[model samples]
Target chain A: MTLKLKLHTKPEVPLEADCICPDRMQSLNMTEIGDLVTYHGNRQVPLKNFFECSGEFDGEIDIEGDLVNVKHIGSTMSFGKITVSGNVGVHIGAAMSGGEIIVEGDASDWVGPEMYGGRITIKGNAGHMVGSGYRGSTVGMQGGEIIVHGNVKNETGHVMRRGLIVVAGNSGDFTGVNMLAGTIIVLGEMGIRTGAGMRRGSIICQTKSELLPTFTRSCDYLPLFLRHYFKHLESLGLIISDSLINSPFERWCGDSIELNRGEILLYAGK
Target chain B: MKIKSTTIVDTFAEAFNMYVSRVIITADSKEWAIAAAQSITGFATSVIGCKCEAGIETIIDPNDSPDLRPGVSVLIFAMDAESLGKRLIERIGQCVMTCPTTACYNGLAGGSPVIVGGKLRYFGDGHQISKVIDGLKLWRIPVMDGEFLVDDRFNIQEAVGGGNLLILGKDQKVTLKAASAATKAMGKLTDIILPFPNGVVRSGSKVGSKYKKMIASTNDAYCPTLRGVVEKSELDDGINSVLEIVVDGLTLKAVENAMRVGLMAAIKPGIKKISAGNYGGGLGQHHIHLLKLGF
Candidate 1:
């Protein structure tokens, strides 16, 4: 069973819908869910006022219509799945500990911010700070996976302590910035200063790009470790071309100004 | 009972409970895969001196392999998980790890995990990387010919070993032919392996030796040359040679199935009698009663 929600009335002011997670809806009846209060700007209003909710769900929730003003849709949901069929507002899936969130359309800023477990798959573009730590916090995305099939804006995986972030399209500047540990794979063009303060973890760029001056060239050879990740990526339905699988890579080990254990691997062609 | 004019012996094959693990080794081609398998299974005929018993289980197609390469599955058996883990690490490290374009994987996935590549990954120095696919951890170690991908652990389970069928023939040539046919048939049975040299043992032994220093000695009772001097001989007057096929399998059913196949293959002309070896129920706990199998 899935709990279905449709926005009957679009709020002019952004709604802080942090309570929209499946964990909160699994126990409430339709009337009880209607009574659950959500903040619209500074005013508190019951969810039934703006959204029509139905379905007897067991561990899954589906939201329809444009949720561009809905914030924190699946935040802190430790279990179950939340699927958004349209564009979602800021803080979507923020601080989620478990379960999966799949977005079929574009997502706003702070997507999956500080998410620690489960997986989040965005089929469309994502705004800035996806999987990044909140300002003043040193850790981000301590665990879990974030896969964005489309372009991503700045500071993706910023201060990420652990987990994987894969961007299929171009990424804005400072991708994997301040990463303490984890892996970031950008299949397309990457912006400048990638892995700027990464102490450990790997950043793989398929496209030809220049690295930061702080990273020193380690070697030009085929790494055996990539096959393990490639096999995993393939299982996720990501196609890893023969050229990339058999290609020799130029390994640059750095963020030397930090722990010096982080590496940036760029394809150098076969 | 007579089958194909050969007499079926009324006896049982005593077998011991053992720990076994199966490993799948794949390579760029069948040749390389079988080479790695042969090397890993070599010198592992018995636990008496070799410390383990191992053999090639089957050849797998490239499409079925983890890396999409031609592969070979091998079964290795020891007395316990600790010994099995040690032998797997040592053999895979020296044989498969050194073989060209070879990758090792655990064939059994769901039992108690025994460490394999988890320990071998250190050979990569600092370049080794680990990835979890479908919740199974695999390690990639940087090698000269690309990378060596190995599963982190292999499942181990209790199994049966030393299940045997003895062929007594009119002559050495007849015994060899019968044993060859029996081995050929038993090879088709899954989850079992004939671990002896050529999958046939000529130097079968008894429980104890006449010498005080040796724990086991040759079975003089079945030796045609010692027929006259021995206290008792199990062989008939025309029987000049005896060949034994020992089966080690993942379960008692597997060993019994293999023994049935072997007996069917060996019960033919030129073979006078078919029997099994046992130390009067004193050796092993698990017994494969040849007559009770009704094959």
Candidate 2:
């Protein structure tokens, strides 16, 4: 039978399960799939104390619960699909490498951080640092994609190395700050200091941008390749749609500190 | 079948296997787009002479193309997939990429897939950016005028080449005029393109060379010279000049349309007779019977 871990009740002290990414558990042939995991007196506690667990060993696992205070719900999982029906805590899919994880609700800060590859989708607002590097670290998301339907907190992509991050709503301050490379597209008006001190990569904004002084103003023209690229992305079931991203733009290049070559394309004025 | 006393051949116009690619160049206006397309598609008539064949496929409306500007689709073909790929890279990199207000896009959707943007991204000097929209990846290479956006990859497909006809005219002037008229008429047809210099060639060649080292030589059978030496001349008594138009297509129907339109226009005042060159059906597996088509 397919194993299931059900959280029938709420928890205290914001439970921290650091090694709980969906990418890691997809391959587990757990004979004891119903093990209740929790914390007790500063150490790890049995999950049976709070939730009722059921079923036998199987490749698939269903995690059902209101994990609002449960941090690191699915940090890295590979191969199987994990569906979280309710809101989650911090570091939701940190450093994920593979498999598919779906959070039916909001995710706390650092969701899918340093993700090498995999797919993480949140149907609600995502916390700050959606795909950023660890504090004091240089590299950010190298690969993978995160789609957030709601608002995002600040510093969404600090020092990102690769991959795509699409936000359908407002992006808070410091979005794509010092980004080394990769793409961070915001459908709404960009907050101040967008792409501040960036070196390489692209930050496509649907709304006019509030540029940082470091980035030099570049010419305005229709970039032919961008149009076809948008077309390709649309066919991939990504959030990129013609009506939203297909429009004229003002180009800018700068953050010369790294001898910067990255580009920032702000939406054209109506 | 017959129309206005003109014969509609019951036999089909057969074509040969070829590799094809579609290129879309976008410009500030339709005029410039047309210009760029014309420039790139020039000197492409037939693989036998020019080594490739190409033509403008369609006029793209402003809102319909990339950059929200006017654009046109160009179809190019080569004898094989490798040659098609090589020619595409050369033409796009040299012509479209260098041209102002023009961005190149791939038209054909699938074949031995490769990356164009991934190769051209080196121009960015490590600053090129890639954006994924709807699963399509695009690279933005930093250029002097902001950035040049190009698709990372384009699709390729199998096509047909050497679908052609030879027009016999009274003299050089009349022969050129008829070739021009035929080209004009064939231009209206879609999915098929005539890639060559002015879509016409006077030096049409035959299967083999007279010397041991050569593979192809001039088609003496259609030559006005050596009238007695060349026993089977398709040209009539007054015919002095011959011009060939090669067609490339996505399908047999596409090639047929070009043949019908081009031959009808070529058969006007200065022309004597129209025919195709084939090695007793040996050169290719498929054949186009001129006599049956003229019936």
Candidate 3:
């Protein structure tokens, strides 16, 4: 069964709906689901005032219409799946523990922040701070995977302890900055200060990335272990070209200012 | 039963339970993979004297291997899981780890878990890194060529060991030939290993020895040289040599299938008779009766 939620009216102001996650909506009836509360601008309002819900129910929830003003679309969802056809608001899969979420349109900032488990795939552009920790938080994305097909803004995977973040398109500055431990693979160009202050983690750039001055050039060779990561990403339906799979990478061990062991791998070949 | 005028003796081959683990060693080429496999399984012929029995089961195609490299699947059998675990860790660490560009993986993933790289990671001292891909943890120990990737743990399960047959012939030339043919026929069997040298055991043993200090001694009953002096010599007038092919399999069906192939291959001319050893059902619990070969 599939649950369909269509926006009935475009909100004049931003609406913060924290009840759209699959875990919270899986057991609720259409009436109960509509009665879920959200803040329209500053005042609290029921979800029924903004969206119309229908369809045979299953673990899959489909959200339709432009949700650019909606927030917390799939926050804290641990089970089931959620698919959004149009643009979505901030914190798309914040703190998600399990299951999967697919966004067809662009997603706003803080997508999958501090997620524990599960996977989030965004087909369009993503705003700033995708898969980053909350401000001043020590850890971000303890587990799970976040894959973006389009360009993303800055501060992606900030302070991530574990998990994978894959950006297929260009990324803004400070990608994987202050990372404790995890893997971040960027297929496109990246802005400045990549892997800055990272304690322990890996940032792989398919194209040349703007490396921080703290990073020292190590060597230019193919790390055989990266094949495991490439094959894994291939299994997840990502296109891993033969050239990229066998390409040599320029290794840069960075964040010497913090005396950390993080590494930045830049693709040295086409 | 008679096949090509050779008689199948009316006896049974007794076997006992053992723990088995299959390890797949992959390398940059088939040569290195096989080189490591040979070293890892060396000196492992029989559990009686050698602590374990191990042999290469088959060659894996590069495309089929997890690392997409040429590989060899080897099986090791011991008295129990604990023994198998220790033997696997020691052998793989010393042999496969020393071999260039070789990575070891667990071939039998669904079997009960047994430690492999968990303890071997100490070789790195302090530089080992663990990567978990698709729920399988692999330990990467930095090496000269690159890194040595090995699964954290292998798997072990109950298996059958000591399934064997004796090939009796008029002379050593014919007896060894018949045993060689049988080994060749059963060598391709999956989940089974012929641990003896060239898959033929010349020194078949009995349970006890006349010397009090020894636990086992040569089977004098099947000794053609002792036919004149021994009171219970089982050899016939023309019989001069006897060889055995011991099988250790991960499953009973695998042992049975290998026996069927081996028995048929040993029935050519110059082969006088086919028999098997047993302690009269007092020892090993599983018995493969000769008459049930059904060939």
Candidate 1 has a TM-score of 0.92
Residue pairs in steric clash, candidate 3?
Answer: none
The CAPRI-style docking tier of model 1 reads acceptable
Query: What range of 10 consecutive residues in model 3 chain B has the weakest lDDT sum?
Result: B126-135
Among all candidates shown, the one with the greatest TM-score: 3
lDDT of each residue in A14-105, candidate 2, tens digit only:
77664344444344444333343545437676566555656643555566888878876666655555677888888877787766678888
**How much does each candidate deviate from the true structure in C-alpha RMSD?**
2.6, 4.9, 2.1
Better of 1 and 2 by TM-score: 1
Error in Å for residue B42 of model 3: 1.4
Model 2 vs. true fold: TM: 0.79
lDDT of 2: 0.73
Q: Which sections of candidate 3 miss by over 4 Å?
A: none
lDDT of each: 0.88, 0.73, 0.89
Model-by-model DockQ, in order: 0.41, 0.37, 0.53
How do the residues A92-203 of candidate 3 rate in per-residue lDDT, one tens digit apiece? 8999999899999999999999999899999999999989999989999888889998999999999998888889898899999898878888988999988889988889
Question: In angstroms, how far off is B88's CA in candidate 3?
Answer: 2.3
**Candidate 3 RMSD to the correct structure:** 2.1
